[model samples]
Target chain A: MRTLNPLYPTCPIRNIINRMSDKWSLLILSTLNQNNIMRYKELNAAIPDISQKMLSSTLKRLEEDKLINRKMYAEIPPRVEYSLTKTGKEFMPAVDMMVNWALEHFEEIVS
Target chain B: MRTLNPLYPTCPIRNIINRMSDKWSLLILSTLNQNNIMRYKELNAAIPDISQKMLSSTLKRLEEDKLINRKMYAEIPPRVEYSLTKTGKEFMPAVDMMVNWALEHFEEIVS
Candidate 1:
């Protein structure tokens, strides 16, 4: 196995994991994974506990990271929607594995 | 898919991910995954950038989460070693998948 240097700023594993490891990113990603597409308000409503500020910033970060795309429509009030990018969609299998593991081990670890 | 509440303290996925999501824990876990068993100093040496205090605490947290085991020998100088617990070992396949994904997508995500 190749050596992993967690402190290396550009290390792929570090960079990827850092992005996913944040408190809200995975949840948001998984939320989009299930919903396919969501409006900003729908996402905020779905993740009830996240503040509007956090949700906005996390969405922006995901967009900047190329994990999710934000689309705006030219309409009366304007419609903005979020969905996982192809790369983001590709990443979900790993996240699914993690979610399954967490479900299986939740009691053992959290207790 | 089940709904995930990121803010829920007892939510299994959140709990497990939070534990693995820290700056050092996954790196330490992956290091141990590769090494099988290592002494405290060996771990410290392997990850050149981690501070002694942070290493000690992260190891403790992993142990507390039942991810790793600490063994001490009653010798003249005393010997201490660390290795993954059964649960920790079980969790690594998921980590491996994430690592593989990171390697494959590094350029696209990090650029």
Candidate 2:
């Protein structure tokens, strides 16, 4: 009979994966991973399908989680940029592997 | 100017991670990974907090996604066992990394 690990009372992995598993979180993270930094409009353009509400809310959540850094530049137009933090950058290797896994087993998974 | 990868249209990674990111999926997967094979009751006991409904639904989803296999034996009481599929086994390294990242950044993440 296997037992649960006592160290994890609430399961932090669940919290972390739950954030990563959101429909737009990984997409935003992936986009930011490749771009290094992106403006709000640029991100909207990159992922044409995401709604303004979703993009903004997801960005806020990611920022709250500390996965992404948000920087605001006061200018004539008021600009903000999004980029992966060190922790977020570290998580990207796993994300890449996940994409590769999906590609490798695409047929098997679909069929 | 970074552009979206043309290879992914609807983003298959989203589907894969969505399945994995479920609150219970990784926990169940991590549990199954350690035990090799477990009976339904054993799994239930291992994850004591998960309601029966959630456990059943999550297991069904995992099976549908082809990440785990379910086997049944015909008998008076009947027997069922769950184990990770080949693809599931392959994904464990990434899961391990995520857990490690969570542990490494636990302090920063919570604060």
Candidate 3:
């Protein structure tokens, strides 16, 4: 049996949940999942409500966590694109489950 | 294809994710899953780091969302207890998946 000590900040479950539970991470991840790859501008366009600062910070955090990859081109204007890493791809099942559950129970939950 | 317009505040996925993704909800739910049932104080004690106000509000929100049941007994002083509702119980598979994934990828994620 796995004993969960949520009080422990270092606990994997705590860390992962805290990271993924942030306001924009899931929205960004799911958008990448749907689009396969997107430029920074495109991502900003996709989640229009996200402020530029929040999108940049969230993307940096996600990149640091290795859930998403950031690639930059050396062109005159420069270009950057984002996509999920293998681990990020592996993490989608859990996200999908949550999405499905939300769809099924949304009415009951909000009513 | 199910279109997810996360910008819409009423979107089910957005609403559900925002609620569950709150700092304490997942921890509280998982704690309840492990304990089966508990009182307000027991829950507060179980999650030692949580403030009384936070625990109280999170529990109330969970109750309001129908994810938890709050039962009251008419006794000398009155007794109240908490347990997962049927829908809450049904939601465990997704949580389990998250737990498993967190355990499996913890090192890779943080390293």
Candidate 4:
């Protein structure tokens, strides 16, 4: 009898891609990519369709993943903003590739 | 009175990433990236945790998305091999970045 290699079975590539590949995550990342930095209301306005719950949860996940940074201001009203981290910036090229691929193959794919 | 830009609201980046970011899809793509070309059994062996049903469905989605190419050889047992298409190959650098990011930040994330 032979045993399977436990190390080979755990897939980090799948894990990371699964985390980052959600609809809102990619959209939020792309939105941030374009705007560089945006406030919560700004993000909500920029991507009109996302619900507040979805946006908040996705932002939280991305922040926890260290791909995006969240900063809160001490103003009386409390200003909060989000931006890509250095790692997130490094991830933009990959995002660009995905966007370019999608744009080029859009018709073929959606048809 | 104002109207929203419908064009701006439809997110292709999100659509494409959502399609590609599933667990098995990422693993299969990474396996194909490493092996370049592999038969059904080879892929199954390469990614151990994936159930046969999950693998088959992921392969179909990837094929439909045109990210992978499936070549069938008529033999007594019938042989099918899979490889990344040009687009899929182009997508590898992004995969590399994801893997690199995972390696760099795994502990921070897992803890």
Best candidate, TM-score-wise?
Answer: 3
Locate the minimum summed-lDDT window of 10 residues in model 1 chain B.
Answer: B1-10
The whole-model lDDT of each prediction reads 0.83, 0.80, 0.82, 0.78
Per-candidate TM vs. native?
Answer: 0.89, 0.88, 0.90, 0.82
B1-111, model 4: which lDDT tens digit per residue? 112236553456655656787667888998898898899999999878889999999999898888999999989789899999997887777777777767776655544
Candidate no. 2 TM-score: 0.88
Over A4-98, each residue of candidate 2 has an lDDT whose tens digit, in order, gives 23555346665455566665888899999999999999999998878999999999988877899999998978889999999899988887887
DockQ of each: 0.44, 0.37, 0.41, 0.35
Highest DockQ against the true fold, candidate: 1
Give the per-residue lDDT of model 3 (tens digit) for A10-104. Answer: 66556776787665998899999999999999999998889999999999989877899999999979999999999888888988888888788
- Name model 1 segments beyond 4 Å from true: A1-10, B1-10
Regions of candidate 4 where Cα sits further than 4 Å from its true position? A1-11, B1-10
Model 1 — TM-score against the truth?
0.89
Whole-model alpha-carbon lDDT for candidate 2: 0.80
List candidate 3 stretches off by more than 4 Å: A1-10, B1-10
Output the worst ten-in-a-row residue range by lDDT, candidate 1 chain A: A1-10
